[model samples]
Every structure is written in C-alpha cells, then in structure tokens.
Target chain A: MHYFDCCDFTIASEIAWPVSFPASREPEVEIRYRNLPTDLGEGGERGFRFHAKPNELLICVDGVARYLIRGGKEIWIEPFPHADEDSIVAFLQSSVLGVLLLQRRFLVLNGGVFNVDGEGIALVGCSRAGKSTLAAAFQRIGASLFSDELCAIKQDSSGRMMAWPVLPALSLWENTLIQQGGDVTKLRPIRPSIRKYLVPTHAKSLSPVPLTQVVELKDYHGDLLWKTVDVKEAITLVLGNTYRHRFLIGMALKDAHFLQSTALIQQSRFYIAQRHLTVTSEDAFFHFVRTNLAL
Target chain B: MKSIVWLASYPKSGNTWLRIFLENLFFATDEPCDINNLRSSFMSCSLDLFDHECGWDVSLLSHDEIDRLRPEIYTYIDSQWENVKYFKTHCAYSFTGSGEAFFPDEATKAAIYLIRNPLDVCISYAHHRGYSDYDRIIAEMADAASCLCSDTDQPFWQARQKILSWSLNVESWLSVEGFPVLFLRYEDMKNNPYEAFSRVAAHLGVNKSELEIRQAIKNSSFEELQKQESLNSFKEKPSRSKKFFRSGQNGMGYAMLSRSQVASIIANHGQIMAQFGYL
Candidate 1:
C-alpha cells in the first residue's frame, strides 16, 4: 500500500504514484483495484469516457482501464487486459484525480499554479495555451510550481482563495523540453509512443498557498494585449476554463460551481494575458508575466 | 436527432468563404461579420470541445485514442445542443481503427464538401503552410498518408485531422453512404456565386429573400474579405502565413507551377480533376 498527499487529501492507493508527495497521515481517500461494471445503468449523463451522477462518476479508457470514483472518498480501478501501466497511471493522476476533487466540491481549473514569492498565481487556459510552458518558465526563474494540468482551489475561514498543491512535475512536449535547454534523449516519454515528458521542477510547494491572481493565457498573433477583467467576465472566463465543466450539470453541482466561481473571483484578481504567438523565448514570457503581474 | 452540418473540405478550399457567406446570410447586418468572432460555425477539431465533451485532457490521449472517442463526443454535443450546429473540418471522411465512423451518422445532418482542383490546392496550400517548394506540396497531395497537425513533438489547439491526399480526401466525402453530402466545386463558387450560394442556402434551409442572398454575396465578396483581412487581421491566419485570404483567383496553379509539378499533380489526381471540370 502507498499513501500520497494531493490536493489537501491524503489518499491511500494500491498503485504507487510518482508525481504526488508521500503522505504520513491518516488517509481521507482510498484507491482500490477491482473490476468495474461496463455500464452504470440509466439516469445519468454520459460523456465519451465518463458517466456522471450526483455522487458517482465512471471513467473508461478502452485499452487502459475503467475507473469508478464515488462520493469523493473512494476510487475503484479496473485495468484492462495487457494495458500499459504508464498510460493507466497517467489517466489516474489526471482525469481520475480531477474528478475526485470536483466530487469534493472544490473549484478546479484546467491549468497550472505556481507560487511567486509567497502567493499563488494561476495560469489557466485550454490546451496549447502555454500554461505548462509558462509554469515551467516560472519555475526556472525561481517560482515554485504547485501543480500543472489541474489546479484545485479552496477557501480559508477568512474567505481568501487558496490553491491546493498537487504533483510537483510538469508535463512538457519534446519541443518545449528542447526550448527549455533540456536534453530530450535522456528523458522518458510520459507514455510509450507519446512525445510528452514529465520533468520535475527544481522547486515545488507541498502546502496550500494563497491564490492572489488568475491569468488566462490567450494565443494572439499580434502584439501582447493584457487586460484585467471585471467580475462578470471573470466568472464566465473561470467557468469556461473549469476542469471537466461538462460534468457539472450531470453531477448536479452547477449551483455549487457557480458559487465557487463567484467566491474565487471575489478573492483573486483576474486578468487575460494574450501572449503573442511569435514570442517564443522563455525569457520573454517570464519578463512579460513579471511586468504584468508586478511580481 | 441529427444536429451537426459539417463544412468539410481539404486545406485551402473555399470552406472559409462558404462559412462567411452563410454567416452573412443568416445574421445579416449593416457590417460584415467579424472573421474572428464567427458565431455561425464552430471548428469540429477544437481542443476545448473535445476536452469538454470527452471529459479528458486530449493532450494525454494519442491521436488514435482521440479518434476512437470522436463519435461519442459528437453524440454528446448533439444531445445538448439546441440548434442545428455547423462545424468546420478539414479531416477527410474516414473511420477509426475500431471500425466506427469519425463523424457518426446519428449526430450528422449533412456534409457540405468543398473541392478545389489539386493543381490549385497545391498553390494555396503551399502558401497556407508557408512553403515555397511546389514539388514538396505536390508530393504531399499525392501521398495518401498526408495528415494535418499530426506532429507529436508539440501540442495543437486543434485535433489531428487526417486529410489523406487531395484526391483521396475528395473521394472519401463523395463516397460516404450514411449521410447526405452536397459537393460544391470551388471553381463553381467563384465563377457562379449566385447559383452556388443559392444552392448552399437552400440546402441549409435558410429562408432568406433574394435580396438578402445577393447582399450576403456582396458582403462576403473576395475583395471585401481581403479588405476585412487587411483592416483586422484574421485570427484563422496561420502564424507563418502573412494573410488568410490570398489571391482567390481560379488558375494560380497553372500560373505558378512548373511544367513538371503540374504534370505530377495531374498524373496523381487526373481522374477526380476531369470529373470536376478541372481537366
């Protein structure tokens, strides 16, 4: 048995995870290896890979595995015959973990969070919006990465938004690795036949940090246009970028998600950072964020 | 329950022009529709849509894996979408390794397949890709394995589009049996905008008057599109390409290509070319 600390939850699992930090506390969640039913039966919303209800969700990857997460407390995994271990674990860390957090009613965005000085700054966007790349650049420039690919957020007693730290490594494409001046030939791909690699950062925070700013990276061809968004726009932006937002309606958490977004925007300043597609250097990105966020 | 109408084409065809025309026809106004804010049609290969509907980060999935789930994703979208949604795609009509159609019949209303001459596609596609080599472009159009955004080295905002060769792409759409497909030649669109666009409006069941159709045609004219592109740069313009709306002329293929390049394209796609009046 292995225990890991992730997103403020101590999880006990049958499979050892390389990404999360080892936990020494009583577990709040349990991951077990068992056979999952092919069908969840009627009366729930269905997606390509998942079936969601108010308290349960099932994620099925044809050749990888079927994962059933219930009530944010237990995860049942059924690995397919001859499934690649790395691919199964990758899904477990990404989609499985993300759904569990949402089941716990936490506000999760599909992006990365990095600690700048003592505060957490979230860089959120859809895929290829340079979230992981910018987070990697921030790490190189002395910021501590809290998580990448999924940013789970919560609130303290004083109503301040806090970012719960997850995995310490960043999943970067081969081109990004090359641009970051790292040797690609030495690192193993995240999964066999995939070009993305998991590169551990020099600095990472295990504890939660105050999330002060949320920046949405947009891909624009022309000059970089950075602007602060009002609360209404921020709510829309945050909801649009929410991780697995389609699951909200199916899980009957639409109102909760909205309340979370409203609460988050109240605490964190939101901005849209349109990065010029032509700007390729890491230093340029680091300088841009530093100048815009005044970090 | 079919709700999706696919604006399917090979690269550099009149897909964008048709989309702009439809936008003007449906949402008529004093000014032309913003090329950036195209509310009429959404991209079928959008990374965000896949992530939202599939409930997984597409970056973590392989191209084949994503392709396998595409039909289910479309079904999910169709279930929730209220109106008849138009989706633009460059992917050729094909099936996944699991023997399922990429565009499922249950979710697909119809497909408006746009075909340009391989000879001309060679010219426009070279520009769109920022390549000066006509020989390389012709070779890719002939190779059946050609695909768009299939590189694994970097992530893309759009999903991997399996375009195949120019001839194969056109043939694939023309041969689909499950759904009705309306094939519109790019040459016909240029030479006879009235008849071609009228056919498009009728096929889409848009109840626009004759005057509205004419006005939409005028509003989305090649010149107007070029002017708009100049005034406000098109978001769809490739990072490498200078402009999205290049010369929309008919025979740039013959004008630019060397004798050997023209012969190579003709040799590869002569059958489809002759059938479509390109011969």
Candidate 2:
C-alpha cells in the first residue's frame, strides 16, 4: 500500500496519491480500488449520487468512480478503467476528501488559503471569481502559501478551531498567469486538454493556523468594491462558499454544515472582494488589491 | 421523470422576453423577478452548472472536451431532478466529436425556437456585443460555423454556442429529431402579442384562464420590462449596451439597416426567409 499524509489523515491507498505531506503516522484510512456497489443502496437520488445513513455515505461518479466513506474513518474507492491518474486525483481532491471531511463533521470550506504573518487568509467565491489568482498574488508578494482550494477547520484539544492548510499547488487559468506577468511557457497544465496551469508553492506548511479573513470574490466589473458582511450574512455566505455545498446537501449533512457555518462565522471575519476582467487592464485591479489589502 | 422544456433561441431573439412572461405566469410576484436571480438555469452554456454536475471542474477541460461530455452532464441533471424544468439554450442541434448529440433526447421533451429576422438580429447583435461592424455581423449570420463566447482568455461565464447560420439555426431545431419543437418568429410575437403568447401559454401545458394569461401578458409587456430596467437594473445587460430592454420593434431592423444591408440578409437567408414570411 502506498501511504500519504493528507490533511492530518495518514491514508493508505492502492492508487498513489500525489500529496507531498510526509507519511509519518499510522494509516487511519484505507483507499481500495475495486468495483463499487451498483445498487447504491437504492432509495436516494441520481445524477450526482450520494446515499447516506448515520455513520456512512456512498458517492458515485457514473462510470468514473464510487467512494464509500464509512464511519468517517475509511474511504473505499471503486475506480473505472476510463478514469486516468489525473482524473482519479481530481475526484479525490475535488469532492471525495471534502465529502469525507464533511462526513467526519469537520468545518471545511471551498476557498484558497494563505498564511500572512502566521494568520490564515482565505479567498472564497464561485469558480472564475479569481480566488486562486488573488491567493497567488498574496504569496507572490511574500506570504507563505498555505493552501489553494480546499481548507479544513478543525478544533484543537483546547476547544479552539484553526484553519488547516491543504496541498501546496494552485490551479490557475492562463489569462490570470499572463495578467500577473508570469511566463506561461514554464508552467504545467493542470490536466490534459486544459490550459489552466498547476503552479507549485515554494514555501508551504501543513500545520494549522488561526484564520484572519475570508474575502468572497465577485466577477470583475468596474472597480474594486469591498463590502463588510455581518455575522448573519457571513454565516450564509460561508455555508454557500463551502466545498461542493450542493453535494453536502446530497450527503444529508446540512445540519452538520449549518453548525460548522455558525462556528466559522463566529471564529473568522468575512468580506466581499469585487473586481473586473479583460484582455488587458491598466493594472488597476491588481494595484488595488496589493495597496488596499496591504499584500 | 418529466423531461425539461427547452426555451431555445439564437442570440437577440425574444427568448428573454418570453421567459419574463412565463416567469410572471408561474411566480406572479407583486414585483418583477430580479434579473440577477432568475430561478431557471440555462440549458447549453452555463459553465458553473457543468462544473458542479460533472464533479470534475470543466474549467480544467478544453471546450472540445467539455463539449464531448455535454450529453452526459445534461442527462445526469435531467434524471436527477424529479420536477419538470424549463432550460434556455442557443446551441444549434449538432453532433459532438464522439458522433453523439451534444444535448440528449432522453433529457428533453419539447423545444421552442425563437427565430428573429436576420436583418434586425444583426443590429441587436452589434448592440449586444458592442460590435459596430454591420457587414461583419451579416457575414457571421450567413457563416455556418459562426459561434459566440468561445474565447479562452479567462473562462467565460457561458460555454461556446455554435448557433450556425441564422437560416440553419432555425432549420436545425425545427427539424431536430427525437423531440418536438415549435418555431415562432420575432415579428409574429411583436405583431400579435396576445395571440402569439396565448399559443405559447397553451403549448407549455400551463393551466390558466384567459384572464390570468392576459394579466401575465400585461405584466411582462415590453414597456413594463423597459420600465423595470429603468427602475432597478437588468443583470443580463452587457456592459456595452446602454440598456437591454431597448426598442422592441418589428420593423426597427429595416429602419436601421441600409437597402444593401437588408438585401444582403434577404439574399443569404432567402429560402428560410420566404418560409418564415420575411421575404
């Protein structure tokens, strides 16, 4: 079994996952690659399948993969022939692990995380809101790159919750890389037939840190519009900004997500960051972020 | 499961106007439906919807790759939802690289194609995209492979819509196999609003009295839409256009287009033009 340390879990899997975290501890979960249940336990929905009881949830991605997360301890994976290593890795990172984390009742959010002066800052928004772009800007200006997309907030023994950094790679679109004045020729595309690149972090950490801010992104419009959201709206926004929020709904984990949301709202500050996009800009939006946010 | 009803159209057709009327018929709120928060999602071009449905992020795939998997995504979403849905699309009926239909027949029950006069569509298309080149717009309409929003600069809010030529777009959906389709001209809707809309209301299986339908028509009138846009804002309006709900007229295309420009559209789409009474 190939072992890897992922978000504090020592996971042993038949398929070699690309997590760079050192595999030091004993394996807590075993990821098996085999045929999953075809019936999917019946009585649920289709499209994106998620069937759940109290301690277990089954998720299937038709003809691609099926994951059985049991008791939040082990995730049994059924991989199909058509799915490649990249696809399998994507499924694991994109939804599978996030589902497992949510099933384990962790406060997981869909945001890009960065460490600025030992404080974790997250850029959260819909896809193309430029979360990864903004997050990369923070690191380029010399902040420690903590995570790019998935972030897990776990409560330490002292009953205080902190944001746990994820993988050390940022998935970014070509235009974003170009606008930032980085050479695209050096970067590697995240997947086959995709122009988006996977830019690795130079300095990173897996240790947990206290969250400083959560800025939700809106599409590029006129100029930078900043809005400070109150706790109530922040709760809703955080819930909305969570990793595969709809999939969480499918997993029957709404109650857990709600509780986690309330806790997150109380724990961290939330802001809305708005900007605009074009073939080329006057470097106005990029300037506004660095100057205003003190990046 | 009840298959989705597709509100299909080429860009600049009266699809949004019809959707507004339908929205009023179904929801009937005291105020107009917020343009930004429309309850219905699009059929063909929503990038985020595809990303969410496929689980694998589509932003990570080539437009071609995403196009290949389009049928699966649509079928999956269609089968998942128990309630009937109305989806909006502009894609002409075409097969993918895999030789499978991009949109699945099993996922849809009916389609309503809103075809506007190509001459008028040119004016609106120019206004919508802020393109001032009239000849270019005409050429695009006649070009079979013409499409919109295919740039890879930064992921577009919508997917690429290969609408084909104006004539072919109208023909493709009208003769598309496996599902039923109804074609309504932009002029017909403008000339006989009540009759045209009533036919639409009846076709959608909307169980409403004549009075209710009339009220819906009044509520979603062109003037009402323009008024609502002025009062609040239309989120779908392009940054280029001064306002989205501008001059919903039948012969405005003729008033705006030069004699040669009109001749160009008519000559190019002559057969399809005669079929639709545009000649």
Q: lDDT per residue, candidate 2, B82-147, as tens digits?
A: 666788888888878878886679888777889887778889888877778888889988999988
Q: Give the lDDT of residue A277 in candidate 2.
A: 44
User: Who wins the lDDT comparison?
Assistant: 1
lDDT of 1 by residue, B1-279 (tens): 898999999999999999999899889986788777789899998888877666777777788877877888888788888999999999889888978888999998888999998888888988988899988888899889888878889977777899999999999998899889999999999999899999888888788888899899998999999988888677788767777899988899999999988998999999999999889
Tens-digit per-residue lDDT, A1-295, candidate 1: 8987887779999987766776858999999999889868897888767899888899887778999999999999999999887888888988899889999888999899988777899999877788888888878768889888899898778877789888878999999899779898888788886899988763434778888899998876556678999988998889879988767777888898888888898889999888655444556766787799987
Q: Can you tell me which runs of candidate 1 are displaced by over 4 Å?
A: A41-44, A202-205, A276-283
What residue pairs clash in candidate 2, if any at all? Answer: A220-A275, A220-A276, A221-A275, A221-A276
* lDDT value, residue A191 of candidate 1: 83
- Candidate 2 CAPRI classification by DockQ: acceptable
Q: Candidate 2, which segments miss by more than 4 Å at Cα?
A: A1-4, A12-19, A30-32, A43-46, A49-79, A219-224, A249-252, A274-295, B40-43, B54-56, B230-232, B239-242, B258-260
Judging by TM-score against the true structure, name the best candidate.
1
